[model samples]
Target: MENPTFSIQDIPPTLLCYAVAELDFSTLSPNLTNSTLQSLKSCGANQLAGLLSSFTTITSETLVSLGSLAVGLSPSVLENINGSILKENLQSLSTINNWSATQASIIVSKCKVQSDKQINADTLKQLGSLVIGVQSAEIKTLKSDDILSLANNSILTGYMEKAPIVLKKQFVQGIIQATSKTKKTIFQVVPAELASEIPVSNLLDSNLNVSEINQMKWTSSQVLPITNQAQCKSYFTRVGQANIDLLPQGSPKRNTLLSNAKSCLNINSNIITKDNLVILGSLVCDLTDKEIISSDSYVLDALKICSSFTDSQKVAIVTKLKAQYGAPSKWTLSNMKQIGSLSSALDSEIMKTINKSVMIKFFPGLLSVLRVQHKTTFTSVITQLKNSSRIAARDSLTCEEKLTTDSITKQMDLIVARYSAAQLNICTSNETLLNNLNILGSLAFDDDQLKVFKGILDMRLPGGVPNEYLIQLGNIARVYSEKEIRSWNITSVDTLATLIQSASWQSNDSKINEMVYRYLQLNSPNATFDGTLLTVLAPYICSLNQTLIQNITSGALRNSSQSLEVSTCNQNIKNILFDKMKLGYSSVNSTSNAYFQIMSPVIGGARFSDLINFGKGFPEMDLSTFTTLNPNEVKTLSVENIKDLLGSNVLDINTISSSSVLQVWVASKTQMEVNSLGVNATAGIKSPVPNGVTSGVGVPHCTLYLLLVCIMASLLYMDNDFL
Candidate 1:
């Protein structure tokens, strides 16, 4: 039925009579509010009585929430309210056999205006009885004069005892709820005529097992009908916002979310009973700071939901699933061969984007996963769940009853297989890179991990990160032609230099700049990192590492020292530096490659570069006109040219019987320093001064940058050789 329409003049007769009778004193109950009695007493008993006699009625629903001030008044105040000459509805009070003195007074003051004045007086004399008849049985009725005083005294006692205060609370809450409901309905129609008609109890009856409802009647508690979609959405949004705010940052909610995302690769359908929305929601909530909103993480999760779950589970989950892709079952390694592109438009979540790099490294493991694991797919499960929800709209399940591990792993496997190697490596290693590798990426790589990343570039999972891990790592290295290492998280010079050195050593001449670019990108050569830090990077460009690689490749780097005792041809370079120029460089005459030795002699670190880069393109040299090539005029040459021009042979003066460029012998001085050119490296130590630049130029301006620029035009010479 529709609502009954009414105007002011159309008020119901019952409502009118009830309203007028309310003004009469008959409406007063035996239990008067002391607060009300006190308030009206202040207005005098005659006026208060008259107001009560003419009291009107209202709808029971509206009136159910009303209360009075009787509990707040003293006995004297109640007496004053009764004695004041304003009441008229007490005429029928004479028949009372038993009543409280308070009830008698209430009746008389209410009926005093009766046409039969005699009956009115008589009733006032005996007033009592008939008070909701079933409850109040033993009280004696009181007479006219005594009734007023007794009622007033009772009212005072109520105020003192705080008995009537309880009654007022119910009245106010009822009024507030009714008024709000009425207002809400005034603008919007409530389809159900009454509370009993709501389907809430039907939807949540015993089988739902939703115990422990919050008893408060806040607006949120209202069982809003589904008919109002806007209200329903508003309610859910409010709930979601509250949940996010309540969870603090960095808590479990924030931590390890990345790892959880990775686990999606191995998730199986055995546990896909839970809603797919949980994964979607977590992706949204946890990806707080990662800049990419529609990131790789989001897409992967959405795919997992759409593809991995079992048919039954799928029907129950994936709420608000805008994507219509069908679920798949029995994922096999062969399925891996099907998807050409790794990215699918599933859900665009943030964690997926920021950590896409780390996820790339796990392909081998994931490939291994595909070869041996599991039966059901996430698609079957999610599909089953969605179907269930569609059939049972209001039915919801508990979280644990929702998802378990066996189920979650099936979902993750699809993600692992679908992701690209570069992207996955980064995402997979996010934890390691962000916290460990990234921080020390610039630190000195004396540590074993850095060494592993540089050389091992690709290896077993437990080993250090590889170049391919950071998306930008290989790009900056400029070593596109070389086989890529996997640790891109190496932001530190030590790690980057290690990567640089490893790539440079194994790298072809063309690929050197690529390696250099990557190293510079990580180390930021122009960015002013620490000097000690820069020292670590120096070796990546030029290193004693070559001696070992040459051995590894030719069965030479691993040889014993005796095995390396220079042959007639090998010693020319070795003996030249050893006997002629006498410049100390770390030396090992081919001992077992594992057992290495270093030179303790006072040779500056930079001299090693001249020795290493001599012929292998450390900046090739092929100068044409030494006389015509002025220092002011520069010409560019390949790293190979510079090396050909600067080899030990060029520095090897046959008459002098020396193949080394120049000597750096030790002085008796205890300090380690530079000695201009020929003296001990320790001959030029300076005292500490405010903001000083060390006057050390071990590297030639032509070694990397200048060398490439001028290799074709200038002769390779030491500072002393220039003299």
Candidate 2:
């Protein structure tokens, strides 16, 4: 399937024609060789035309040679030649001057000028001579003058008789300078059978004035015919809004125009008007509830005066006004005052649309309205506000409504006076109960309300109690007795801790704390104090039994005590351990069994020996569990404290010697003390190595002498002189 290749120098004339025929002219080289010229010069007019198909540029030399070969133009060759090349070389082609109308039409039709450049006068005249079968598309590029010139030869008249309606419109409209007399002649020449097929748009005829257009015989039958609805819409759009009123009322154009104006309601308010709305209401007998509500305010105002709208239409309009201007959550005291100006039925209908949740939220403002207006029916409205879906009356409280807390309490008091404990309990959600527990207790609930509250707590516990609910529940613990607190099986240690914290918010802090402490001891006797619980109990330790505080705090650290040891805790309790428990060491004495209480603060943070002093014991512990002490603590120890502990034999030497960290401490303490005493360690003092200790990890020799001399001297001078 490969095409045969031929070079320009060796290609024979017949073979060149074959190659030219096989290839697209656009793909061929523009360059020409002497052999190509000779080959083309000897070829017939048909072959010369075929070679020209492949040449991108036609030199005068090439054109002159090709023109000499034109004994006659083959119709087939002219058909294959490009139209642009033919037009450019038309003057040289003398045979076309003698051609018949059919031959000239064939040649001109093949000339391919792809641009929008119009044909000049010469081409028009040449084509005009052969106008018998001329096409509209072929001559579409002719100028207005050239087209008018065709009329002079009667060629345009002939073409219009056969051309389609679209071409006829384009051709006639393109001649902006053509006279009405010429247009009338063109129209007169159009086939009578196709006269009615011309649209009204074509007759808006720049050729005629307004008066002439009106006087035309076909103005109604041809231009404004009452046909289908679509054509009527088009006819009306052409007539425009200013002239639409001139049309007959019963006509299809008028009816369609009115229907479209009525149905097209814009969301924008600025574009709509009262007059337009009146016209719209005339066409649409009934508007939907949403449509009436969503329309502009001007439309609503117009509907009110129109008297054609029904009562439902008025209700829908008021509903939208309430939703926008008086929405329950967003409405303020000012809007509540405006309600007094409204009619009784409209005011009641507006209030009825508000659901229970929203009614509760806006209750304070509405209550203020009722009080100011002296409306006794407000009581019934309040009753209607209490629906099953509303969680609690307090939840509807909008604090931003500028109502005082006292005002809220007064309103709540009036509402709760009529309801029994059972009715209030049914509507209250647990969250509402917890959030307003303090207010609930202050409400002075009768015996039945107290019983209902106890039942709710029981119900809340059977499912696992969320921490927030437990904290709030503990706030109202003063309402119940010790027996009741003990009856509730308080499980999670964390919840027990939260109960102790919540007592501070109640009426009697000490009484509630004691009750909760006793309840914790009785129900969950095995509960241990982690950091959180230990912190909650620390402040009350001075008031409660000392043994209980001791059991909670020291029991975790003492090996003999069986309480659980707390190693990790939240940051709040950890901070409390360091700041509060550490400061509590002022109460420590040799007689107490609270040894771990003294050490608990140091174990939580910082070094053990950093907080350590002379009196506190160097408590024995497993060496493997004690690795977190800071290495720098060894250098900061006082010489007097080191000797006091060493002479007292309080720490086991064997256990200290076994630890690498402790060995460093012992060597560092001895070396530092010797330097502080003003002794030269190279000659005066000897290093001591304990049994079971490594020798190589001793203190460095380069440690400066006279360390802490000023500190030691100041302390000794004060003790001797003042004490």
Cα deviation of 105, candidate 2, in Å: 99
Q: For model 1, what is the C-alpha lDDT against the true structure?
A: 0.29
lDDT by candidate, in order shown: 0.29, 0.44
The alpha-carbon deviation from the true structure for residue 570 of candidate 2, after best TM-score superposition, in angstroms, is: 30
lDDT of 2 by residue, 10-69 (tens): 656677654543333334344453335556555555433333433444444444555545
Candidate 1: segments with Cα more than 4 A from true spot: 1-236, 241-723
Which candidate should be chosen as best, given lDDT against the real structure?
2
Q: Which lDDT value does model 1 have at 537?
A: 32
Candidate 2 — which pairs collide? 83-111, 83-112, 361-396
Model 1 lDDT tens row, 144-186: 3332332234322232122122222222222223434343321
Candidate 2 to truth, TM:
0.20
TM-score of each candidate structure, all chains considered together: 0.15, 0.20
